[model samples]
Target chain A: TQLLEQSPQFLSIQEGENLTVYCNSSSVFSSLQWYRQEPGEGPVLLVTVVTGGEVKKLKRLTFQFGDARKDSSLHITAAQPGDTGLYLCAGPFNFGNEKLTFGTGTRLTIIP
Target chain B: GAGVSQTPSNKVTEKGKYVELRCDPISGHTALYWYRQSLGQGPEFLIYFQGTGAADDSGLPNDRFFAVRPEGSVSTLKIQRTERGDSAVYLCASSLSLAGATQYFGPGTRLTVL
Candidate 1:
């Protein structure tokens, strides 16, 4: 099975600070997706990167896919309390694989 | 149109009992999916349905876990002889199609086995 490991499993930072989470795997994926999840709610898709070395920004959040399509990263600029939640990266092993393999998870707590 | 929705927001069951979880996808979405999320972990894919047929169920942990999408819009996940290890949040998602589609997820049902 393809596995995605995330770094800094838990992070607690004060509001207005900057932080980044990383997702890495040995297997290459056709695409990668980032998601944010809050308590009592399902995860919401933040971004999807299909091209290697692609970078996408969503307001305070920025995402980057590795040049090899085997890793990705999420950077939050000037974090807010609203950003405190679980951040996950997911993707399938290859094309035609509908089931997504998710990263372990990064729990971020922004102290306001 | 509404987002995907799962019934019985929380379920507490005894070990060895059977339970059923239901999901209602967004209006007109033909692809429904089931996933399980444990605390401190991301969602693990359990199954996927394209229309009314299960396109892939390889993620299911064992035979005790079964799911069905009879009408292509709503789905049910059934678990037999639930175990404490089975305790987790069951998530449902739906998309217009399965090929690299963006899936919309439901709040999920928290199932606790004692």
Candidate 2:
């Protein structure tokens, strides 16, 4: 089984602090996706990084993919209370495969 | 367009009971997926449907978990003789294409098997 590991399982920071969540794996994936899930709600897709060494930004959130496609990271700047949620990284275990394997999540809490 | 949606946001049942959870994908989405998320873990894929047929069901943990997507739009996940370990959040997602594309997820059904 392909395994993706995430660091900093839980983070609680005051508003305006910056934090980065890491998702790593030994195996490469065709695509990497990041999702944010709030309590009692389904996960919402935050970004998808497809190419190795790719970088994408969504407002205050920045996402980066490893040069080998085996890892990815999500960096949040000036985090707000609205940004507090569980962040997850997911990708297909195999190329041309339809099933995705998700990494253990990173839960972030931004205190005002 | 509306996003993928699942019914019964929460379900509490005793062990050995049978339960069926429902899902409705986006209006034009052709690919749908089911996943189970345990506490402190990410959502684990259970099945994938392309159109009306299951393209991949290898993620299903056991035979007691069965899912069907009839007519390529609505799907149902049925669990028979549910065990306490089966308690988790059941998530439904739909993509414009397959797993390679961006998938929209539903709020999920929190199944609690006591």
Candidate 3:
């Protein structure tokens, strides 16, 4: 099975601080998706990056897919207390795979 | 329903008992999926259903776990002779179609096996 590993398993920072989380995988994926999950809720999709060297921005959050399609990253600027949640990265190992391989996940806490 | 919905938000059962968890997908969605999430871990794929048939069930840990979707909409996951290790949150998701469609997940059913 394809494995996606996320670094900085746990993170805590003050409000307004900036942080970046990384997801790395040995196997390449056709597309990658980033999700943020709040406590007691299922993960909500934040963005999906489909092309190599692709970058998409959502307000204060920026998502980037590596040129080789084997890695991805999420950068949050001026983080707010509302940003506290678990972040997950998921994708299919191949183009038509129906199941997604999820990363270990990063739990971020933004303190006020 | 507005999105995927799971029944019995929480379940508590003892070992060797039979348990059933239900999931209701969005209207007209052809693809549904089941995943299990242990404490502090990401969700693990369990099964996928395309309409009323199970397209793939490779992720099921063992024979004790079984799922069925009879009407092309509602799906149920059944666990027979459950073990203590079966405790976890069971999540259900649905997508318009397989390939690259976005999946929307339910709040999940937290199962506790004693």
Candidate 4:
């Protein structure tokens, strides 16, 4: 089974602090996606990284894909209370199947 | 709707009762997906539909769960003889196409099987 294990299952940090969440897997994926979900709401896509060693930034958030495509990371700079939410990483089984295997998830809380 | 929409934001039913969750995808979107999310966990894929046909249903846990998208725009998920373990949020998502496209998610339907 292709499983994505996320580290630091829960995080609580003060505003302006920096934090990083990791997603690792034993199986290689063709692409990786990050999502943020609020309480009582479905997850919303944050970013998708396809190439190995590629990095993408969205405002204060930075995402990186490992060289082997078996892992990924999300780093938040100067975190704010608004950045608190559950972060998940997902990737497809291969090129043909559209189904996604999701990470265990990281619950982040930015205390103001 | 501008984005995916789900009905009956919350449902509470006794165990052994049947339940149905609905999902309306964005207009012109041909791919629809269903996922189940339990407390403190990420959403798990349950089914995926490409148009009116289910391209993949391998993620479904058991035969008691079934879904259909007859017209290719809306879909319904039915659970038979529901158990307490079925309590969770059922999420719906849609994309313009199945390949290499971003998915937009609905608010989700929270089902509590008592």
Candidate 5:
């Protein structure tokens, strides 16, 4: 089984602070996706990075995929309370299949 | 368009009992998937269906876990002899088709086994 390890399992920071979370895996994936999940709700898709070394930004949130396709990162600039949630990285081992292997996850709490 | 929808937002059942969770995919999505999320962990894939047939069931933990998508739009996940370890949030996702397609998720059903 392919495994994705996320560092800093939990983070609590004051609002407006910048933070970055990493997702690493020994196995390479065809693509990677970032999702944010709130309490009592399913995960909401944030971004999908299909190319290695690709960088995408959504407002103050920036996502980067490693050149090797085995890792990725999410950086939040000037975090807000609305950003407090569980951040997850997921991908399928094969491009033809839809089953995703998810990362352990990073729980971020922004104190407003 | 309406996103995926699940029924029985919360379920509390005794150990060794049976339970069923239902999911209604988007209006025309043909691919439905089931996943289980535990405390402090990300959602784990459980099953995947393409059309009315199960394309993959490798992620299912055991034979007790079974899922079916009879009509290709709505699906159900059934658990037999549920164990305490089965307590978790069951998530359902749907996509227009497989092959790296984007999936939309439903608010999951929280199942608690006592």
Candidate 6:
């Protein structure tokens, strides 16, 4: 089974703080995506990184794909209360299948 | 619908009972997916449907779980003899195609098996 492990399962920081979350896997993936989910809601896609060593920024959120395509990172700059939520990383396998494997997740709480 | 829609935002049922969760994918989306998320964890893929056929169902934990997309637009997930472990949020998502396409997710149905 392919497993994606995420670090810092729970994070709590004051507003305006900067934090980073990491997702790592031993198996290579064809593409990776980042999502943010609020309480009692499905996750919303933030960004998708398909190429190795690729970086994409969305407002205060920056996502980076590892050079090997086996890992990814999400960094939030000057975080606010709105940034508080559960973050998840997902990737599809290389066999042309539609199934996606998701990481455990990171719950972030930004206190104002 | 504007996006994927799931019925019964929250369902509470007793153990050994049967439950069905419904999902309505976006119009023209050919690929639909089902996932389960336990508290404090990310969503785990349960099944994938390409049109009316199940392309992949390896993620299903047991035979008690079954899903069908009869018309390719709406899908249903049925769980028989529900167990406490079946308590979680069942999410449905759809994409134009699964090949490198972003999936649009529904609000999900929270099923609590007591």
TM-score of each: 0.98, 0.97, 0.98, 0.98, 0.99, 0.97
Order the candidate numbers by TM-score, best to worst.
5, 3, 4, 1, 6, 2
- Tens digits of per-residue lDDT for model 3 on B1-114? 598999989999999999999999999999999999999989999999999899889999999999999999999999999999999999999999857999999999999999
Residue-pair clash count for candidate 1: 0
Write model 5 residue lDDT over B22-99, tens digit each, in one string: 999998889899999999999999999999999999999999999998878889999999999999999999998847
Give the alpha-carbon lDDT of every model: 0.93, 0.93, 0.94, 0.94, 0.95, 0.93
**Tens digit of lDDT per residue, candidate 1, span A13-91?**
9999999999999998999999999999999999999999999999999999999999999999999999999999999
Decide which is better by TM-score, 2 or 4: 4
What class would a CAPRI assessor give candidate 4's docking? high
Q: What are the C-alpha RMSDs, in order, of all predicted structures?
A: 0.9, 1.1, 0.8, 0.9, 0.7, 1.1
Compute fnat per model: 0.77, 0.85, 0.77, 0.79, 0.92, 0.82
What's the true lDDT of residue B32 in model 4? Answer: 96
Q: List the residue pairs that clash in candidate 1.
A: none
TM-score of chain B for predicted candidate 4: 0.97
Q: Identify the leading candidate in terms of DockQ.
A: 5
For model 4, state the Cα shift of residue A107 in Å.
Answer: 0.4
Kindly list the per-residue Cα lDDT of model 2 for residues A10-79, writing each as its tens digit.
Answer: 9999999999999999999998999999988888888888899999999999999999999999999999
Query: Candidate 2 - CAPRI tier?
Result: medium
List ranges where model 5 is wrong by over 4 Å. Answer: none
Task: Give the per-residue lDDT digits (tens) of candidate 6, residues B3-22.
Answer: 88999999999999999999
- The collision pairs in model 6 are none
Candidate 2 local Cα displacement, residue A78, angstroms: 1.2
Considering DockQ, which of the candidate structures 3 and 6 is the better prediction for this target? Answer: 3
lDDT of model 1 at position B105: 92
Candidate 4: residue pairs that collide: none
* DockQ for candidate 6: 0.80
